[model samples]
Target chain A: MTDRSQLPAIRQQVTELVLAGSPEHAEEAINETAEKFGDLAVVEVLGELEPQVASLHLSSFDGGKMSLATLLIPPKAWAESLAYFAATWDEDWIEDEPEVLAESLFAHIHGMVFGTDDEERRAELLNAALATDWGTTAFAVLFSTAAEEIIEIANDIHNLGAHRSGSTTSDHDVIPMALEIARTNEEGWDRILFEIFPDWRPGENELHAASEEESDDDLGDEEARESEFAMGRSTKELLLRLRKQVPSKAVAPAKKGARPSLGEDIFS
Target chain B: MNITSYTARTPQLVQALEALGQRADEQAAGILFDELCGITALVAKKFTNDRTAEGIHEAFHLTVGCISLAISQADIADTGEAKLSFLLQHGAEYVFQMGFRHIKELSALPYTAFVSDFDNDPFVQQRNLKAIFMEICSADPATTWSGDAVYQNEIVDRKRNQHIIDCGKWLRKHNAAGVVRDSEMDANAAITVAVLFALSGDGRIVARTAQRPLENLIAHIRDTKPDVDASWDKFLKKIPPEFQPLLRERMEQLRGTIVKKLYGKTKPKTLLTELQDHYIGSEQDIDYA
Candidate 1:
């Protein structure tokens, strides 16, 4: 939707503002430009102007000062920028490792906006991240570091019945995706899940109840129903096995709506 | 290949020296110093102290050389001079400290050579003269020591004595007007005095001349109403341990006077409590030697 010809002028304006000792103005200009242009185009400009922007930011010597253009820009913009970089990463264009760059950007976003009261922005950012393959490694790290934020976003998405177009991703897709990614690093599965569900446990009755609840809802078609059933069965099996595998001492205290305790002493 | 192996690692040493000289700030200097420390540790482990002395001497020489160069090229209007001076002073101190820590008997040749080089360099001498004049001129009038009476009879440099007189006159004029400016220049002036005193042959005599200034500075600080964020603690920390007793004694005397000034007639217990609240005593030791 953005006019391609305006980018160079915007960049020049930003540079002039920074040079004129109006960093706040420069930040405003950058954010405005990012909003006007799509994320990919703005990110390309940012990548080219990274050194100049970094120098300008570092000259002031206040870490908390949001002078970094990336920080001032929207979360969705950064997510999309990251996605673009991941898609088009080449060794000749970018000397630094793409994964490292993506991780650092994601970490910065997570630090600034993850647990804040910006639920809509957080969901959009998470969705943008999930939309890219470059985010898999970053997500694994994020899953551990920001389990609550990720889980909260997943729950919100589920409640709203939001799914990516042309994909069968449902409200419960996040758990399976997380499990698949987490299995690559098997050592973190117990800790990650414990932090995610906290007091979750698997029992036959609970599994049955979850299946019945799914069935009662509109599943759309026979194929959809069969697929949902298969996914639910696998998820329940994974959770049950994971619940069993987790050391009893590591289990969190039960929350109000958490499942009741089973009689078996897993720790023993 | 045999000849190459036999050759001294002078290029590597030069490269390291250049890298060190290029450090423009305290943080950079600290990083370079840490690297030097690591290199020195490794060298010490691998070779004899005699062999390691070459590298150590080269480092010291390069540090002094860089400082001399910076001094020669300093522009006071810009902050470059202040940054360079900070790097030089702290960098030199770090080098000496590390050398003393690692090498038991650090050869004095490199230090002597640096001093000789610094003294003979006309640019450096001129800079030092200008610095001494500036330090004296900007010094707190109330705390400015009148060295004319003490050094008049002694056979000292005429220019130095004249500068001292000029400083005394300026201090009298400013102190009468109650004009005081707190700046980094003040910290630099103090450092200049300390460095000059250390480099002088008759350091004890210099210390004696500074006694009045030290006392006046302490009294002036005490007379000022204390605040929670007062820089008095930081000033105390800056003074070397050898000079601390003199300042401490002066501070205690000033405290008594201030207490009397505050309360015309107070009990000993009340005075003690008031003093305790006003002045926080510190236990940390400062070593500048």
Candidate 2:
């Protein structure tokens, strides 16, 4: 086996290759390192990428096999450029030839959200993304993701709100599991959704709002744009189910219920 | 709302196409996801205006995620490469069109009556729930589908097994692939016939047209569960030195593509699949001649 100590130097070497705008070389280096150290070693090294220098990894990402590396790199630091973050997460971009596609960029953002086991780091990343652009703000993008996922997961667990026959029980099946899964993501979700994401209609940031950039002929009424943020009805139902079945801070209240009381007659 | 925008020019995809141009079939598989993305967008623009660069990108990711799950659970490879052929039969655009279609169905819930009054038909409920479930899964950072072991082993697995079987069988000539017990010949006769078939150029297993039959035989090997993995290492002792390379190369190829743990302790599994009748377009049939 190669000397274990040299791995740090190799990681540094790979970082330099990435900075030089030669992603292909970096990929080859990683693949070689993987053969010697196994995938986990390289994944650890890549995850330790200098957040600023490694930003070039995504910028220069092309058709090389470094798709995995581009995926793992942290977002460009806040001090480095909000414009860069805006470009990656912007809701209204129309590139003639997009160097980065929405799917890949979102995958990177998802990676950034969970990159550290540290809950505080995830919150910091989420907060920065939310603050960067009002157009399809980070909250909207992540909520849309959570909304779609909740509906899908509900199908497996809810069984159409009917109890299963014989040995099956909802206790064994969905709720406890949902609560546990909700807990697994203590870093992101629940608190992040409820606390940081107060506005569904964060309104258009200068970058992603199209009307300001486009001519008047392309204009539509404010009503059409506002309608997009109403949230999908089925998604709303699933979140409701989640809040009811497994209450947590990650869950958002679609509409606040009547004020609570110790007893039904207490308020009366 | 789905992110919707369009760009006719995608330089990264263009680069993927050019890179694929100089690569081998083995190498091409690695870049297939990227290659499919570009091809899907180009093909999709003809059919719908709702697509955004982001929508198409995410749609393909979901579709491939479903495909990967099917592949992982299927008795596809030491089981057999039958499923990969199953993949190859469809034009890339067709697979992607299914994905874009899924995106539309997500909010519409067209198949399920939005009214939650349970349908009297249990199968209808199963169909609708699975359809909804496919719309999300463990791959998403957003969902908790992977949290429960019972949900996976007891509930989700039945869905998994059926999906790959459907994919594995859907494209084959209806009877060409199946359980080994159904094979018409006994082992000795099958061996003789296989040799004779190889002697005849039209029936050679290595030819382009024999893709289905070859996959079928591999499926049979998996089902039959011959203790080949135990014997595979020792068998090399009997082979003449000159031809050993050929046998090793062939085994390696199968290991890389279809069959798994070839010389290991376990019996392999087989996979199959079906296409929705609606996915078929009238004019798109290939000319067999």
Candidate 3:
């Protein structure tokens, strides 16, 4: 890591770039840092700085329209981001890469999808997405924590399923490629799930208590279903089935935080 | 993983599920899954009632989730033509197959034609829905949070925090008949607390609470930001009189902590977060999607 003392200065500089300069300028600086110092440093600076940016929503609102949902992936940034997801569980990261990173990204009910649009309102809704920051500011808002599940969803869902009539992939194409590889990799699934659903993981105490409660015949079905959801057992089961169903040869996730594994294969 | 995970489906959907399995390329599976899964969110909202939004949300999520779980964990495909329009196309087809049956024009058209028509439907458009709902709430003289541009401004501007609070107020208020339904009263109360818990950044509001905590919170918010309180109208007023204190407590709790990622990382130590934690009247709206 760069000198720990220097971290705040880097954060302030990035925040200034995010607010004052074009998002491209801010992101370029972030990407440059990833190249020079690697993913961990940039992720660290971003995790600290995103909240600072969050504070400046009033300040960054206009530029953020362009910035929001715009992911700043420098090379294999997606793969490297996944690599650090597992690390967020480590005690050290809680200060910067907290566990709430794992919660299902769909907390707000309707935020899940854009209602279908027709020609007249299409431009209106399209402008709304941009105004809402489905661009660069969006990636900074959503992805800075390296929420793998949201990233995975964003790849296919087309801006969290807003279904803008002609929207395209927001992240580097390598993300979908990276997600496919990581999902197929045994360890990668663990890291991704660990990053996505920290509270629901099997070892959590509530599941154990519920499992003990399951012995009662009357409570059995309800508790079992609850336990299953809590443990992510059903998801694990479905994924196990998917392991057979999906045809990808498993490839490992890249090791460093925020690093994108931009293989020639990703390009092709 | 068991194909039987979803059963008793109509043959067409069943056939589609099986065909979906034919996707061997990581990219193809990912694209198909992303498309199917993304469209589900648009369709899922159709099924929401006051109470079961969470339950059905998970159900629709899992339905698409299991069929396409592999894509989330799999590979990316080579780029081709932008299929952005297909998302709305398929999304409309799926919702029509499930919803929009009531619209005469939509029902008469084939799925392709409905895509454009569906886009124009006010109910489906986010911008339209907010304006329509706000007009409903604002035009009604009987409702409480009425008579002001503040609510309209927030809704028009797409500031979701106030909109969420407004939803709780509306759910508690009387409907078209001007009476809160007995069946819905229970759901309304649950929504009140849920809204409180969500906005407050504390789960305790959802857990059963003693009475004193709430009264103190109402008093605190009233004292601290009395201007906001006048706007709040002890906004929980429409819910059961007994539950007002509970919702009030949450409205005052951690008012704008940005609950998901920022608070956890910086809440404890960073002065920046401390400043960020204060609630501005939500001139800024931050939706995760």
Candidate 4:
């Protein structure tokens, strides 16, 4: 892991560039600079104090809007790019190198947007993603965290003809492809949600609960039936039937504070 | 895990025994069972002292009560044929600790239609019914909380007193006609309107308590002025006896205040102040005495 002390440099560079400048002016600089970097093909910057980590497009080119984001962080937390896939998905990531995969994704998005791989800014982006206050700021922090691979793809597509050895993917096409992959991964999570939250799931049981009047009536009827059968059938059968009927999965809830008394014959 | 194991065993035996008996209605029986299961879950959360046995027991009992109430409401001879308006009103009264006035308002066509057809309209339909009720209450202060805490409590106390007076009046009115048909609506409406009157803090208490004397006065007025409207006379007579005198005195004081302001002894609170002032004396002299 990189030492934590290095984060200040990354934060300072971002504050100086993006924060110090107006959003409109910074946006213009970003668009002009991203094209310049893509044309040059070699990502290099000259400076002792002001290191150019990446070029970002802050305006429209080819009808797509450009926005700029920067990141500064310690090298220790810089090894891997982590993407938060919250709304249920499958574990489709097949690669063994998690950190390398993350880094690659980060480099891809940054390269696509800026046309240069700026490590200082990349590091800062990673730090922001891992920070607790991520939600309060612009949504780009989240996009940046996920942008690693997508950025690389965009950059490769933008500079497609430069490397003659292999063909490059186009920038416009890369985003839709990445979105398709993301959606594919999200299907499993959707299934899990349906399995958990019945109200969100489709069915008569879910619909009945949504109603104001009949829900109480339905609940009443269900309870009476369960109690009537509680003595005549096995508890396992009763529970199984209930679980099958209702969408909510049943786990024997944890008994709190003290053990329950089994002697009372309230049902009898 | 131990408790789960124990519960798993006992409820099974209990279930087995329960299944052997014949139920009043198997469909209703199933619904009741489901409700009990829900209540059991609720009880488990609440009375956790004996989490295992007590939770299950409490839930089972509550479930039984819930099912019984549901069945009773449903089994009554009149079901769907009962007017939706009355059902909605009664349902609100039973479920919500709402005052009668609110019950009337929510059940009114405009509000009920807005809630039920909210989705097609989008602007108002998506809102929850209870939230809409609270919003309506918040907009009208007198319809909700009384102006002050003391007044609210007094209103509640006077309301009960007013109900007693109403029942007495109804009985007297019924006796005069030699009719003895029970009227739930009349009794309910009396208490409900009295609640509003008390809440208004209009010192309608004396008038409300003076129902008997007022009724007698109205009966006399109708007998003498056979051509006069009986219902209008009844309404006027229902106004408390003390309120008439208090209102007259207030009108006189208002006239004096207005005259003083008109003469420039006191500046009017507004430009057209005389128009706003009470001409109650003239109105009352012609009507009441």
Candidate 5:
């Protein structure tokens, strides 16, 4: 665990070095800046970056581990720089969704140009930026937009509670409950999405297999067995029906007995 | 007195009518009269594009106002015939709009569509309403967009009991970060807020004044000087010990040049400039690997 007090010094060094020029010159400026300002911005930004590595905390009892990741964006006045470069570099593509790509590009430049002090953070941020189609803006937009919409919904529901109440109803009771639902649905969506599909897009096959595995892990309870069967039956029915309707190029074998039979497997 | 006659006479009663429609106990005639008046007021606002007290008395019926009238009749036994006739004529056209869909669905319910008071089964109505919103929003991507696309995607992504819990976790992280205050958020509240936020594409949650200084500092990292790992560490320390490593690990894995690209700015005076610079983009070179 790192000490939080060191942040101020690191922040100062990073600030001075950012003002100074070039990676080569940065070392000297950072040192001087650190001595003068003590752990300023430059060092804070550049210091602890580790390459493509993260810590995973494991349960002492189960030895189960979970990966902890990082994303580091360096501070620089590169917004205009990135926008201009993107605009001219790919004029044809710029019109497609400039906001999306600009966000991605700027995010990339920020990380690479300013660089990370933490090696692990540096690697993670850079990697994530490169790996994901959209960059920080997408994330920021998603987060902020979601928050705003939720608040609006909550306010609307609250207003409805107050505005729509009858002789028997009290405003206090209805508003808070409606507000709570609006809030829950808003926040739960992202967490659920990320948890289920960390990759952003988990295909149906992968999704099914994951669910099956999850079900299998639980030794057969009657309810679990029945639910799994029901799910499997419904999924099969959906796939078969879809295949028939779409005239699939590929054939899927219908499962015997337990699975719904689509006569003359279309994919075949 | 016939409710429709009253509604026809008093045009400004739609809001009151809608409010009356919410309650089971309201004298059906009185409620109907008030709702018609509210609908008239609404129509007046629509045609005039603003409200005038006298315009509220204009008895002219818009398509939606008619449907609302019909749907209101769906509730009462005595007025069902005349209202049904009006609805049958225009309900198809009116139903195309979202507000009428809400009216139609609520009218179909055994309980009044709009509830005057909070009930123990508030979740039932809330969920039903939310589902209706989702349907309306998702009807056509071009015509109607989900305010909570990301959230909907999550639900559609997987079928799991744990999804609810997982959503709570995501909401908590987002709620605590930058300009978002602890007072403004809790797990349940965060989840609801996230859903609404996702749908509308508006990010404002808590007031800027309500946020803590450390929260502001974190915002600086995310928007202006993004050191995801560092910020993660800084944030994690402030959070409960159990959550620190979890958040830290997530941030660590999310790092890279792209992550760097997103947030590495050095503004001397304030973090806002750096955030804006990134938001707008800079005239820099692209480094693709």
Candidate 6:
């Protein structure tokens, strides 16, 4: 790895490129530093200087489809920057190269900004990142944490309005990763349920019951009916099945300092 | 492996082609029929001079017809023209090969002509062509098939299964009357029945839920059929061995109740009178009964 002292200089160079309105150049500097120092060094630098790096925005002409503040700068620039940096690296680096280092670096930055302290913001960032097709490295970095952290992430994604339109990330993409983490621990289903039903709680059958009642009423209003129908029948059935699998006692109590449970609020 | 090994044996290919010939009665219309024509034309280009190519072409046509029929019969809501078109266009070669190998099994149905003759043939109604395709492909020698073909088939099978499971869940959620009235719902019911037959003894939990819809369907069949014994016999043959006895007992109970209600101690009415009296109730009312 590159010496720890060199990171400040590298960050300064990247920051200069960004200040010059050339994120493409900034990305190149970062990738070059990554190849020279290794992914860990690059991650450390990126993590420390995350706020400034994340704040760098591409020109509108550079296909600014994502949220302006997003880490996914234009692919062509990112690719060119990586290509230049990759040329300088040894051939040996190719064999065990982190293919999605760029995405991982961004994810780490996200982790730092939306640090573990604020559960809600952390989840929102994770979901938003996922929405933009975070590569395998990003998924590994974010989700390979503790089960409680994983559950919190799942709950935040499920409960928060994280599915920003035009994002490629889906619940389908997120679930299997969360489920894999959940499977490793005893309170796995709680995590799985948190991911599935945003407002899931022990012995709470409100959503299913409400859906049933809505279905029975005359569905003359097309928009309302369509909206109701959009809450997929199969999804409800799968939720019910998952609910059956979960023991009522397994419902995670409210976090010591966290907000009251959605279920508690509803039921009360 | 040599190119020859990749090519299917002549007999299997011929059998597949002959199966396609059986669907010649299907009128040329709709997206499926157009696809059948496109596939036939493409396959024909490969072996233009070979007389056997004609058979292969027919097989392609029949395979498409069978799928189209199966989707329509099963009331498969999601696997509409667009999905079929996408599959045919993207996985053209795999589909063609699959159709060539499995056309015979699909065409083995004795009533192919009868069913294909009508735009809305009840006899051809509600078959799970996706499951049939999966079963046919599953039996083929994996060594001879391309990885893309196998992977594509897996994707198709997964999507098809998910669709059926979704349909089953939807059916379970909604009332029979509200659901059965929709063409897609009816198709879903038929698909569920076809899936139940295909996946019998596979121990899928989703398959078990098919029982209620299947029971409702059997009742409908009983109401419609003039020869209940013949219809029941045909229906029972499709059911798995374990479920057959239970179904038979249920059917008998149903028949007995209908008989007692219709005949009573009064002079027995004609069969037509009984049919009119007992079976002429509204479709919605039948489920309640």
Candidate that would win on TM-score = 2
lDDT tens per residue, model 1, B70-154: 3222332323345444434444334323322222211111221111335446676545443332222121212222221112222
Q: After superposition, how far is residue A235 of candidate 2 from its true place, in Å?
A: 16
Residues A202-222, model 6: lDDT tens digits: 333222212445556665763
Off by over 4 Å in 2: A1-5, A37-44, A58-102, A107-142, A145-183, A195-268, B1-289
lDDT of model 6 at residue B233?
A: 67
The TM-score obtained for chain B by all candidates, in the order given, is 0.17, 0.25, 0.21, 0.23, 0.23, 0.23
lDDT, residue A243, candidate 4? 25
DockQ for every model comes to: 0.00, 0.01, 0.01, 0.01, 0.00, 0.01
Residue by residue across A175-223, what tens digits does model 3's lDDT show? 4323432333324333434333444544332321112234455766766
Ranking by lDDT: 6, 2, 1, 3, 5, 4
Please identify model 3 stretches exceeding 4 Å from their true place: A1-48, A52-268, B1-11, B25-28, B50-53, B58-289
Regarding DockQ, does 1 or 4 come out ahead?
Answer: 4
lDDT of 1 by residue, A6-71 (tens): 777777776777768887887777667767775665655554454434335323323345444543
Cα displacement (Å) at residue A94, model 3 = 31
Chain A structural similarity (TM-score) per candidate? 0.31, 0.39, 0.25, 0.23, 0.21, 0.32
Residue-wise C-alpha lDDT for candidate 5, range A18-80, written one tens digit per residue: 344333343454455445545534335343422110010000101121111112223221211
Point out where model 1 deviates above 4 Å: A1-6, A12-23, A31-268, B1-289
The sequence of per-residue lDDT tens digits that candidate 3 reaches over residues B1-289 is 4434232222222233444455344544454454444444543443322247664554353333222222211232311211222222243233223222212222222222011335546565644443332232222112122212232243344333333434444443533224332221223233433443333322222311223433343444334433444434434444566556545665555345432222234323342233224422121113321
Model 6, runs deviating above 4 Å: A16-21, A55-175, A184-199, A203-268, B1-289
Q: Each candidate's iRMS in angstroms? A: 27.0, 25.6, 15.6, 14.6, 20.3, 25.7
Task: Give one clash count per candidate, in the order shown.
Answer: 0, 23, 30, 55, 126, 5
Q: How accurate is candidate 4 locally (lDDT)?
A: 0.31
Question: Model 5 off-target regions past 4 Å?
Answer: A1-104, A107-115, A130-268, B1-66, B69-289
Residue lDDT tens for model 2, B93-118: 34334333333233233231112234
Native contacts kept, each candidate: 0.00, 0.00, 0.00, 0.00, 0.00, 0.00
- Compute each candidate's TM-score over C-alphas: 0.22, 0.24, 0.17, 0.21, 0.18, 0.20
Give the TM-score comparing model 5 with the true structure, all chains together.
Answer: 0.18
